[model samples]
Target: MTALVEMKDLKKTYKMGETYVKALDGINLTIKKDEFVSIVGPSGSGKSTLMNMIGCLDALDEGTYFLEGTDVSELSSSKLALIRSKKIGFIFQGFNLLSKLTALENVEMPLIYQNYSHKNRKKKAIEALEKVGLGDRLHHKPTELSGGQQQRVAIARALVADPPIILADEPTGNLDSKSGKEIMDMLVDLHKQGNTIILITHDTYIANTARRKIVLKDGKITEDVEVS
Candidate 1:
């Protein structure tokens, strides 16, 4: 099978004062289309660093990284932003919604970046909310929605662009158990429908929901296992 993502001897480092922190070191991995992957690690295990690199939110210090078969390290900053906009969708632990925007408008934001016409953007945004089972909550502001509902809106925003890959950072972290389960169910549903999903979480139970789990420790992968 062809890989949607491939990392070859990838390393990321940061400097603080006179010390250097190795956030990711010589990590080699691959994820094919339609696969759901869970990254599990401790708070300081470099999972967040890896997630940022994988999400194209940060650049790698060394090694080769490819997404959709394109070498990301070679792209210019502007080109990289274009690539990210075209290929990736992101969900975060925080809802990150604009307080002034409604759920529908939040979902419409990505399309605005893509320069889509207003009519088409609204159409697509509504469809995305419908897909996330939030069609009826389109006009609700973030404050008016429950935590799970807000998360569903976030997922809808992630889907609006119809990007093949979704990089979610601690997607279910802020919700209660019931809300977390609902969010997990939506993720599984999306995966079943052939979305490529990579979820970062510290919760083992949440990680178990994915087909494969990669455990990181001290900026290195300590274990890689398939659960399904």
Candidate 2:
């Protein structure tokens, strides 16, 4: 199977005054299409930095990153933005929804960026919400929903674009145990439907849900373990 993502000798460094902070030392990994993988580590382990690069939210200082066979390091900011908007979907621990928008509207926002017609955007947003089992709450505001439900809306927003890669950053971090499990189950369901998932979490239990685990420590991959 062709890999959906490949990073070779990826490195990211930040400058603070005269000192350079290495966020990612050298990460080499391949994620196949439709696979579920997790980046696992303790705090300040560079896992989040790796996620930032993968999501196109940040750039690497050195090495090559290929997303669906396209080199990203050489891409201009505009091109990178296009790729990020069209090919990657992001989920955050906080759900990041506009408090004023309803779930349907929140999901529709990404479609607007893609220039979808109003009818199609609404249709797609509803479909995405249903996929995450939130069809009935389409008109509800994020504030009206439970933590898990708001995150479901976030997932819906991510799915509305139908991006090839779904990059989730500790999606269940703020939820209660039951809700966290439910969210994980939803992710598994999406994975089963052939979505490539890249989940980042510090929790071992959450990380173990993925078939493959990449553990990071001190800005480097300490182990790449396959659990399934």
Candidate 3:
């Protein structure tokens, strides 16, 4: 498998008042194309920090990060944003949908930044929504949908741009067990269909849904294993 993401000697620190917290301590990781991997850890274990670094949402204090062979660790914010928009799709636990926009509009948000025509954006958004089994709810607002449906919208939004990597941060955290299971199934199907999925979650069951599990603790990775 070709390497899609590579990190070496990654480090990050935060100043908490009079104290310094080592959020990430000399981390090194590599994720390959078409792989489904879960990063699991308890609270304050640096999972979120690592996610931010991988997603290009935050800069690391010291390290080299290569995404698709391009160095992204030292890029300017605008450059990083461009890289993120083109290569990475993000799904958050909160569903992050705009309350006033309908599902179709929300899914079209990413393309709007890329100078997509209105017709093209609408067409792609509809296709993505259909992929996530939300075609019938395209015009519904987030408030009108259930938590699961809202998450489907989020997934559609992430997929509409056809990004190479999907960064799902606790995607099922806000749903009931049944809904969460459905979301996990969708993610698994996505992985099979060639999307490189990086799932960040603390739930053991959710972590195991991926083919590979990476455990983090005290700002370091303690275990990296493949599941059968």
Candidate number of the best lDDT: 3
Worst 10 residues of 3 by lDDT: 1-10
Candidate 1 wrongly placed segments (more than 4 Å): none
Encode model 1's per-residue lDDT on 1-228: one tens digit a residue: 558889999999889789999989899989899889999998989999998888788899889999988898888888887777768888999978898999999999989888899999999999999999998999999999999999999999988898889988999889998998999999999999889999999988899999999999988999999987
Q: Looking at model 1, report the run of 10 residues with the lowest lDDT sum.
A: 78-87
Give per-residue CA lDDT, model 2, range 1-228, as digits (tens): 557899999999988799988989988989988889999999989888899999988988999999999999889998998898888999999889999999999999988988899999999999999988999999999999999999999999988898999999999999999999999999999999989999999999899999999899989999999876
Clashes of each: 0, 0, 0
Question: Root-mean-square deviation of each candidate, in angstroms?
Answer: 1.1, 1.1, 0.9
Report, for every candidate in turn, its global Cα lDDT versus the true structure.
0.91, 0.92, 0.94
Q: How many backbone clashes does candidate 3 have?
A: 0
Question: Of 2 and 3, which scores higher on lDDT?
Answer: 3
Residue pairs in candidate 1 whose N, alpha carbon or C atoms collide under 3 angstroms:
none
The residue-level lDDT of candidate 1 at 176 comes to 92
- Where in model 2 is the C-alpha error above 4 Å? none
